[model samples]
Target: MTTSSSYPDIDAQADLMVYLVLSQLLMRHLTGRWLTVQHVVESTHLWLLTNGGSVDWLQRISLGSRAQELAEEVAQIEGITFDVRTLEAAFSGYQHLNHRSPAVAAIYGACVAFVVERRTAGSRTGSEK
Candidate 1:
């Protein structure tokens, strides 16, 4: 099992997992192995936590419309977060990393957004309570 020795922080692990999940989703989708998308997401989450990242580090991700709904519905079964949205917004953040593949850049951007949102929400809940 690979560890997060290179990325000791929760944020860093989350970021890496985001890229991993997204990239794997796209790659699997291209091969028509769509079912594995969810598996990849779940595996990535487990890998992160087991490798030294926090449980709260899992970021948001999405497939297509129906796929998104299925993910959300199944999430009720396990209380997981399966966010669905377009990659357009996330892709913009990685405009600087032209050398990387578009999918890779998009995942990186999305991870940053997800982590920021999670932190913001956590802060808000703390302030409210």
Candidate 2:
């Protein structure tokens, strides 16, 4: 017997799955995807703070609206700190370039990178408690 059906590319599937997850997460936690990129980024910030910051997976890139205090507490517990200034720069670029199709990808990528950087840094070192 010969194979007929083929499966999708693993990397493409992964990207789609990640996008779906992020889209739903952002929509559910914040407003909807119709909202401006700046609003989306703001929602992410609020969600992170509520979820107990980068030290918690819940706030890593999923359970966004968990609690600012919890985020800070976890970061403190992990002996890590959130870099506001670096993020502020990223956000500025994200917001400024809003309304452009090409920039949309750039904005989301930068924002995701920022969030990942914070979350990964803490957990990567086996410092999370």
Candidate 3:
């Protein structure tokens, strides 16, 4: 996955990349973790009450298996360096933010920010710059 020439199939690759990232986040939220379905819903309601964010629902989406497949695809594609742990942390912050949990967002935001800035900054400057 050299970051040299542009991938001709970027559109398809990007779609897969997005799914891979999103799925990892979902898995972290679900899968017998700290956040249960009830907790997730409660968090959503709390977030809505606190902030005017249009976060209506928080249902468990079935994408764990599929996300695993997408992750493999993303790995096969060149020039893509998104890590599942990074996505998981970003998603944690996003969910917490939706619930008006600034503290949680701050904690997770640091991890997400690091990965995002690292990837985008490379694009802004030359890869080796």
* Local distance difference test, each candidate: 0.41, 0.35, 0.37
TM-scores of all predicted structures: 0.40, 0.24, 0.25
Best by TM-score: 1
Instruction: Write candidate 3's Cα lDDT for 1-129 as tens digits.
Output: 664443123222232224333444455435623344454345444444544433212111222223344434434444433344444444434433221333223323332343345446656786421
RMSD of 2: 13.8
Candidate 2 positional error at 8, Å: 24
Cα deviation at 47, candidate 3, in Å, is 0.9
- Give per-residue CA lDDT, model 1, range 2-114, as digits (tens): 35452234455445544444434444434544535565566555455544444433232422212333323333333322332332223334222122444434444555555
For residue 124, model 3's alpha carbon misses the true position, in angstroms, by 17
On the 0 to 100 scale, the lDDT of residue 122 in model 2 is: 56
TM-score of model number 1: 0.40
lDDT, ranked from best to worst: 1, 3, 2
What residue pairs clash in candidate 1, if any at all? none
- Model 2, 1-129: lDDT tens digits are 423233212232222222333333334334433334454346555544443342333333332332232233322323222233322332334323222333234334444444455445755786421
- The clash count for each model shown is 0, 10, 3
Tell me each candidate's RMSD, in Å, in order: 11.8, 13.8, 13.7
In model 2, residue pairs whose N, Cα or C atoms come closer than 3 Å (at least 3 residues apart or on different chains), thus clashing, are: 47-64, 49-67, 49-68, 50-66, 50-67, 50-68, 51-67, 52-70, 52-71, 53-71
Ranking by TM-score: 1, 3, 2
- What local lDDT does model 3 show for residue 63? 22
